[model samples]
Target: MKILIVEDEQEMLNNMRQSLEQELYIVEAASNFKSATEKIGVYDYDCILLDIGLPDGDGLELLKYLKKQGKDDGVIIVSAKDSLDDRLKGLDLGADDYLPKPFHMAELNARIKAVLRRRNFDGNTLVEIGNVLIDTESRIIKIADEKIILNRKEYSILMYLIANKTRLVTKTALAEHVWGDHIDQTDSFDFIYSQIKNLRKKMDKATITVEAVYGVGYKLEVE
Candidate 1:
């Protein structure tokens, strides 16, 4: 999983990055609103930790921008603001949870897990589709009781495809989701095709198939 932390305070941002990285998430951060806005517009994250009082803009406005763009990344407002109005406005703007600052790291972790559960995996730790079983915590994939080993990028690709199994995941979406900010640095989607080809080979015996849509994108088909 991946996360974006948007906070103006350097120390607070470091703390969040360290804590969430310890939980095995690929973590990235932006200290101000402009940087955060740019990152959010270009990349996709599994979750976003947004602070209300940013240096250049309010975190609530960031949520509104996300709404306008139709991105459904799970958001947890990690603000120093504890007012009921602040919390209510965040929720009304589609934040998954509001976490008051000066909170325990354990509590923050719990809330993030809850949001991810609801948004990504239907409240289950094990993601199963037909014969394939994935353990989100351990990042393990098992097909028909047989274990499979995948490198980090391969695993990320597999999980993203599984998450949007029913839809045709466009190449642009797949690249941005898996590669994050680094996607823009690449010349083409040859890396994406490489990962998808490897993933197809790895799961050849499984009931699911990854199909290319010819000039469009790819779709995961479950036999």
Candidate 2:
């Protein structure tokens, strides 16, 4: 999973990064509202840990902006404010959860997992499609009770497809989701074709079927 940590305190930011990195999440950091807004505009994150007391602006404004832009990214407020009003305001602004300062790292991890589950997996810990099973917590994919080895990008692609199962995902969408906004610099989508080919081969070996949509895109047609 990819996450953005927006906090001004250097010590707290480093602590959050270390804890989340140990859990195998790709993490990026922003110290202020401008940097956070820039990152949000360009990169797609599975979850964002936002600090309300930003240097330039209130994090609530950012949340509202994201909502206005129709971004469904999961957000959690990690701030020094622990009052009822603050919590209520953040929740009302579409924050999945609110965590005050001096929180346990384990608790933050749990909140992130829960938020992701609610956002992507229909509140389920495991996602099953035919013979393939995805354990979101472990970030592992299994077929017929045997684990399948997948590279980082491949796993991300498969997870995205599974999340939007039965829907045609265009090459442009896939590239943006997997490679973020940086894909605009690429001249061709040949790498995407290669990734899809390898994913299909792996799925075929495991008796899982993922369908191609010819010139349009791909779909997960399990069973």
Candidate 3:
């Protein structure tokens, strides 16, 4: 999954980013409101950890901006403001959840997982498509009732494809989601090709297929 963390505190932001990275999530960060607004305008994320107390602007306005644009990106307000009023305001403004500051990363992870589940998989941890079954929480995949193993990148690629199963996923989007900010350093999508090749081999026995669109992207189709 892809996430954007908006916080002005450098230490907290770094901590959150590192913790989420260890969980295999594609994470991006913005230390101030301007950067956050730019990213919010350009990309879509599975969830956003928004800190209402930004250095440049009120984080609540970012939430308002998202609502104005009719963006459905899941938002969880993470702030030091623990007042009931702050919580109500954020929820009323369209945040999916409110996490008070001084919270555990485990709790934050849990909240993000909950929002993603409700928004993407209809609150189901198990995603079944064709003959492939994925337990997202456990990060396990079973094809034809047989468990299969995949490397980290391969697993991430497969999940991204499955998430966009009904649409064509552009290479840029795929790379951004899997590699996060580090994708900017790569010159081409050769790594993606390699990963796709390996992932396809692992899923060769499954009813689902990953079909590449020449000069474009890829699509997940069922046989």
Candidate 4:
């Protein structure tokens, strides 16, 4: 999963980033509203952990920006301000959940899972497409009764593809999701091709198929 942490407190922000990274999520951060808005404009995140109290501006404005752009990235307000009015306002602005400051990492992790589930998997832990099954919590892949083993990158690619199963996923988006933002330093998307080749081999053993769209991108083709 990919996440954006919008916080100004350096210590709290680092803690959240480290904890989420430990859970195998790709995390990025912004200390103030300007950087946060810039990130929101450029990249797509699976979930956003927003601190409503920014040194420069209110974090609720970020939610409003997301709405105006029609981006449905799941958002959780993580702020020291736990007032009823603030909570209500954040939710009304389309935040999926709220976490007051001074929280445990475990609880934060759980809330993120819940929000992602509600937004992406119809509020279910297991995501099912035809006969393929993915356990979001366990990170397990099952084709009916059979289980398939995949390496980290392979697993990430598969999860991303499944997340956008109905749409065409461009090479740029796929690279950014699975390999992080450093992809801009690389010269080619040849690495993606290799991963896709291997992923297709594994998928062929199962029921699901990933179809390449030639020069454009790839899409999930179910049988």
Please report how far candidate 3 places residue 70 from its true position, in Å: 1.1
lDDT of each: 0.84, 0.82, 0.87, 0.84
Q: Is candidate 2 or candidate 4 better by TM-score?
A: 4
Candidate 4: TM-score?
A: 0.57
Identify the runs in model 4 with alpha carbons over 4 angstroms from their true place.
123-223
User: Tens digit of lDDT per residue, candidate 3, span 85-158?
Assistant: 98999999999999888765545765686688889977478988999999988899999999999988889888
User: What global local distance difference test value does model 1 have?
Assistant: 0.84
Candidate 4 lDDT over residue span 1-223, tens digit each: 8999999999999998987877688999999999999999999999999999999998999999998999999999988977999999999999999888776554576578667778777746787887888887788888876898889999988877766554567787778667876886799887899999998887776667888887767777767
lDDT of 3 at 99: 88
Q: Show the colliding residue pairs in model 2.
A: none
Flag regions of model 1 displaced more than 4 Å: 123-223
Model 3 scores worst on lDDT over the 10 consecutive residues at 102-111
Q: Which residue runs does candidate 2 get wrong by more than 4 Å?
A: 123-223
* lDDT for each residue of candidate 1 in 1-223, tens digit (9 for 90 to 100): 9999999999998988988877789999999999999999999998999998997898899999998899999999988978899999999999999988876554566568768888887647888898999888898889999999989988877776775565566776677657874676677787788888888888898999989978567777889
